[model samples]
Target: MILILVKLFQGLYVSNSGEPWVEEAELIRRAQAGDPAAFDLLVERITPYLYRVVRRLASDQNEAGAIVQEAWLRAWRARHRYVADRPLSPWLVRIAVNVARDLWRKKAPLDFADLGGEEIVLPDPVPGPEDQLTRKEALERLVRGVKKLRPEYRMVIALRYDAGLSYKDIASALEIPLNTVRTHLRRAKSVLRLWMEAEDG
Candidate 1:
């Protein structure tokens, strides 16, 4: 899967460290071939973003950290299944999202009321705690409403909206048909819109 999961990501694999964009295809190829250094290189590039993504899905910071580590472990273990031409971040994210979902499912279906806690990194670039606090309370209702969706729906939301991945990228990450990604996005948007409107009322 194409791994350009987040729009605001900081890439360690970029030709220039401070450069936002990176060409990771070769790096992905090497990593897929069981090169530990390659894999480490790839992981180092994505670790912070990976943790943030999991932090949004999981309950607490600690759980998020654990989920991030497990995600890399799972990704490495399943490296043979990777499609190198595709972006690696999405695949890594899919694993992390599923891992978080599985854990959440084991405890409980993620409920609307339970969506609030520490502020999750959203698509927008909020500066810090001061910037986040205002949005946090306002967004909690939106997030909780989103949590009311099916896991599949939420998956799309996280990947497409939160991670800022494209529909094609999401399909690759989810390993589903491209049409399925379209359908999921359509349906999830419809559901979320309706849910949000209701919340507004």
Candidate 2:
């Protein structure tokens, strides 16, 4: 199965002009019908986005990769339960997050202190060496602050910013209410701001 999945992933960019690519909904429908190729296509398209979501919770690249693969396997098994009309990303993200959470439980205590793989890019209106240096420093501080956040806050932050998920999508992914998502984000930002301010002082 792993070899097949790896081959399908490698073939993602292979030209298939002979056949037009199917729409995502159709792909999902086909996958639900147990079409392996359709499911592989879904995996190819969704893995990058899902990895970003998983990386935020993972300790390192290898763990992140494992989490993503396990999530895909679980997704394949649960495809029949997936609602075809609903968007696929949030559902997949939820699975990935849960997988990471379960791994955390089995390992040592969950610690966000080392969650530092994703690059943070800040746009500068006036681009220069000095501006670039400042942005880099700010990004470093922000990442440090994020590492200090509670597990739930870190999850929301990862889902909202790294994964680029909407509030509703984040709520769905985390199995929480929309208001709870908003509250966590708000509180997270506030804590980060306070942490940064204290650092400056």
Candidate 3:
């Protein structure tokens, strides 16, 4: 029996190694076996990507951080239901995005005075003398346009562009139909393009 169990585990490992290293799949396997260490690994691996997506959805850094922390806790509690054969990242991201949306809705309406903090603090904004003003203006316009997007459209766009998720993955993460993902992306692009053109004009 011992030898059989060892062989079975070895085979499982080999099969898993041959497959893709998606976040959900690995976490499911480890979590199913009650491995806390694997859960931690999953969190660390997805944190940076999740942070960017959450940040894009949130109005500010503080809110984004709070949402992300809540998302992780949610993921932890839900780990028992995770299916090991599926990709874990999308499942985790789906939860995170939902949490972000909830926080966005729960936030108090912003006051007009809150708009006073308009200065961007990115490092090295001017790389060269040529095209500096044009590049800066374009980037600012893009940020403004993104910020103005509706929550659903912004979430999908951020997941696609900022978090680098495929359409299928985004669909899975957002718990929406694949066709809806395509629709949202299409609408988001049209709106962003119009916004960018208006800014340019």
Candidate 4:
């Protein structure tokens, strides 16, 4: 599986100007019929986006990568149940999120201090060293704030922001009502804002 993942990552980095999901339905059909090559192709194209979502929930890259791999393995095993006509991302994201939640149940609380290295864009494009430092500090504080949120709120925030899923998609992935998704996001943002403000003062 590690060797297969290494090959998948190699394909992920290659420049493919074509549409990522142009023939995704056909690929899904083939995969559902037990085509490993077709399934590998789909994994190659989708892993980067999946990794971003998993990375937000995981304590570190190693945990995130493990979750991603396990998600794909589970997806492959359940391929027969997936409808080719439906959008694939939500289904896959649901699996990844479930895997993360399961892991969390067995481990310590999530640590966001490692998240400070993630990029944060400021309004000033040519910021000085001081500005850069300030941005990093602010991002660290925001991550710390995220750490304090309830598990459901953190899941909604990661799905909505890191994965860039629509509210409806988040609802589907989380098996929750659309209104609940909206409520969680609103409350989570409010809590994070207050936490950041308190930290700044």
Candidate 5:
């Protein structure tokens, strides 16, 4: 929200072409004035991370998608209420998590096996003779490592690494305090590091 990263670039006058280019102020102004494109850009910029958070929180794929879609619609409908000066991702994710939580609450109770499931079982598919072995091996290892993690740790790692969010940003987006973010990262890294070491051994 404070644009601290941009402050350093201001001195060098270097611009980021790859970073989110939508001007926050301009987007807010347009959205407030009922411009649809501005609202669309806001959704586009935030959807990936918001989806990831919802997927982590939701009980299944359908619920995750539903929550994300509901959150976006609600956000768009309530766009005028959003403070232009605030960070959008946190605001958006807050809406998403709340939606997911509400959905979760409405569901019937589940068995422990359904909630805290064990490692996923996948069929050993037969590959063609010409299949790329190296890529397959690498992917298998990545999946194994991820599957070994606790769901909570896995969600933190996915949100931070796969979603490319900073520690502070993740903390805000997930609605957790800064120390909890650091704790989750620490635990996730430690788990991954141990898994890698064991694989090497």
Candidate 6:
């Protein structure tokens, strides 16, 4: 903890800086011990990661930010319960995923905008009109497929693929068995594939 505090003076060893930094589990341990700065540092470390996770699973920039905040707040409240041996990223992700899922359940509707905001960065300045159209159609079909799933199935799809969360993370987030998470993801992909294929046909 002393070394971590010292490093904070130098930017917490930004990941790309090629400097060794405090691991998330240690941060969480300190946070659980009621260290405010430790908790703040932990939040600082994972804010972008949380934002990316929520952005992929849910929609709206402001909404995603809010979800991440909510997740952090919830995590803070439950920090004492965290298992220190397990890495903190998955736990944080699980909380955010649950928060997003709960919000989605309340909304009870998926829209075009909900599936919007995915950034497509291409090096080429221009893609041909046909290629552009192909990409557009593919995205539309993918969104449509997403809209067709049940809420639970949709959550897994969004968390596992869209958000790039592990099956274990999904399980912890959903408070279900690991195998259940796998099943949900497997069934979700199968359903979406069939739906997309049917749409194509």
Q: Largest TM-score belongs to which candidate? A: 2
Expressed as tens digits, the lDDT of each residue in 1-201 for candidate 1 is 124322223332343356454357766777778787667667767877677666556556667767777788899889889877666777789899778777777775634322222223334648888778857865886677566776666777777776888888878777789888777667666666666667669
Task: Write the residue-wise lDDT of candidate 3 on 64-145 in tens digits.
Answer: 7677778878887887787766666677678888898777677664321111112222335566866688677777777777
How far out, in Å, is residue 136 in model 6?
7.5
Stretches of candidate 4 off by over 4 Å are 6-22, 108-133
Candidate 1 at residue 119, lDDT? 23
Model 6 CA lDDT for position 28? 76
What lDDT does model 1 reach?
0.68
lDDT of 5 by residue, 91-169 (tens): 7776775676566567654321212212323335466643556457645775567655555565566667656678887
Q: Which has the higher TM-score value, candidate number 1 or candidate number 3?
A: 3
Error of 5 at 23 (Å): 4.7
The superposed Cα distance between candidate 5 and the true structure at residue 157, in angstroms, equals 2.1
Give the TM-score comparing model 2 with the true structure, all chains together. Answer: 0.79
TM-score for predicted model 3 compared with the true structure: 0.69
Model 1 segments more than 4 A misplaced: 1-35, 104-137, 177-179
Estimate the lDDT of model 2: 0.79
Clashes of each: 6, 0, 3, 0, 0, 0
At residue 2, candidate 4 shows an lDDT of: 47
Cα RMSD, model 1: 8.3
lDDT of candidates 1 onward, in order: 0.68, 0.79, 0.69, 0.79, 0.63, 0.69
Sliding window of 10 residues with minimal summed lDDT for model 6: 112-121
RMSD of 6: 8.1
Off by over 4 Å in 5: 1-24, 44-49, 52-61, 104-151, 189-201
Candidate 5 lDDT (Cα, 0 to 1)? 0.63
Candidate 6, residues 1-201, lDDT tens digits: the string is 334323433356443345457777777778999997778778767676666666656555667767877887898899889888887877888888778877887785632222212232223434789778777877778776665766677677777765677787777778999988767666666666666667769
- Is candidate 1 or 2 superior in TM-score? 2
Model 2: lowest-lDDT 10 consecutive positions: 112-121
